[model samples]
Target: MSIERIEKRQGATLVAPALLWTLVFFVLPFLAMALMSLSHLEGRSVVSGPDLRNYAKIFTEPSLLKGIAVSLEITALVTVISVALAWPLAWIIATRIPVRWRRLALLLAVLPFWTSYVVRSYSWALVLGEKGVVMNALVGLGMLSEPVQIMATRSATVIGFVHFFVMLLTLTIYSNLIQLSPNYARAAEDLGASRWQVIRLVILPLTLPGVVTGAFLTFVLCIGDYITPQILGGNNELTLPQLIMLQLGRRGDYPMASALSLVLMLIVTLAYLACARWLKMERV
Candidate 1:
């Protein structure tokens, strides 16, 4: 056999395990779900048919449509807020902090990750409640005459998501910032650029990839999260994940649940495509 043939065989051997794993874990389950989505639950049993009823109902029903909108709204808000708050803190840690303490700073930045996600969500529920620490502090400080409604609202949901995803965004942005050479900023300043101009024109453009990556991650995680919204929003509104759970647990409608899961996957896939397109354009 030729040397090239031997090398090809070796390469295939290395790739075969990963391909098999993906086939078993992701592809097979997705195919099953796709098949399940086309069937309908009739009375107590699922009626197998390649039908569009689930898709039709998803688009036509007001409650289902509202769930999609709510999920998107919460995810968008979390992504934007996480990126905005994280970028400055990331920049500060990367650029302003001493090199020796930068590790400690980053560690402190991600301190919340040490706790359980469910625990954190429930903690926020209590903290944002009317009789919670935040409202009591506001009243005590004379900032509010009464405890305003915060818990069981969209605001609480956003706050909970932002708190968690901010750490993730900070790490991504900080990694990108630190990878950049300081000479870029120095050169911009020497060419008569102000500090803000250097940041706005040079630093921001270079860091766009990191910001987009982190935002995309935040979008996926926040949109799919059921615990935070279920706990913080207090069932005041439905999100896609909550709706999916309702279908599975209450209605026992596996077909509808599968369809809703596919919808969620489609949204994440579209987001990833958009990010990939933007990054390609930036490179060009």
Candidate 2:
């Protein structure tokens, strides 16, 4: 064989294992789920067919439709809040903090990630409870006549999501910020731009890639999350993941659960496409 042909063959050989693994783990399972989604439960046994009834029911059923809406709303809110809070904190760490303390700051920012996800969700549930520390402090200081309801509500879910995602977003935005040339900000200021103007016009534009990447990740994670909403929101409403669980566990309807999962996957795919388009535009 020719030398070039040998090199190509070696490259393919190196990638073969990963390709095989993906086929076995992801592709095969996804195909099975897709097939399941097209079948239906007859009493307790699943019957095989390319039925569209599950998809139709998802759209027509009020509770299922509401689950989709709730998932979208919560994901959007969490993404926005995480980006908003993380950006400034990232900027501070990358620009304001001294080099000596930067590592510690970053560590502290990601401290929550070390804890178990389920534990963190339950902790937040307690913290947002009526007699929790947050409410007790507010009531002690007379901020309210009594503790208000935050736990067992949508607000609690949003708070829990925001707390976790902010750490993730901070890491992305901080990496982006630290890579930027200090000269860019200096030049903008020398040209009579204020600090806010410099950040708005120069720094913000350059960091769009990291911000969007992080936001997209946050959207995917938050949308598919079951633990936080389940514990913190106290079953006040159902998100898509919760609905999928109900179908699988309570109803024993794997077909409906698979259909809902596919719908969630479709939404995440759409979001990825949107982010790709915006990033391409930004590059142009």
By TM-score, the best candidate is 2
Candidate 1 regions with alpha-carbon error over 4 angstroms: 1-17
lDDT of 2 by residue, 1-284 (tens): 99999999999999999999999999999999999999998899999989898999999999999999999999999999999999999999999999999999999999989999999998998788989999999999998998899999999999999999999999999999999999999999999999999999999988999899999999999999999999998777999999999998886999999999999999999999999999999888
Q: Give the range of the ten consecutive residues with the poorest summed lDDT in model 2.
A: 227-236
lDDT of 1 by residue, 1-284 (tens): 99999999999999999999999999999999999999999998999989989999999999999999999988998888889999999999999999999999999999989999999999898899999999999999999999999999999999999999989999999999999999999999999999999999999999998898888889989999999999998788999999999999997999999999999999999999999999899889
In model 1, where is the ten-residue run with the lowest total lDDT? 209-218
Question: Each candidate: what lDDT?
Answer: 0.94, 0.95
Residue 51's C-alpha lDDT in candidate 1?
97
Residue 188 displacement (Å), model 2: 1.1
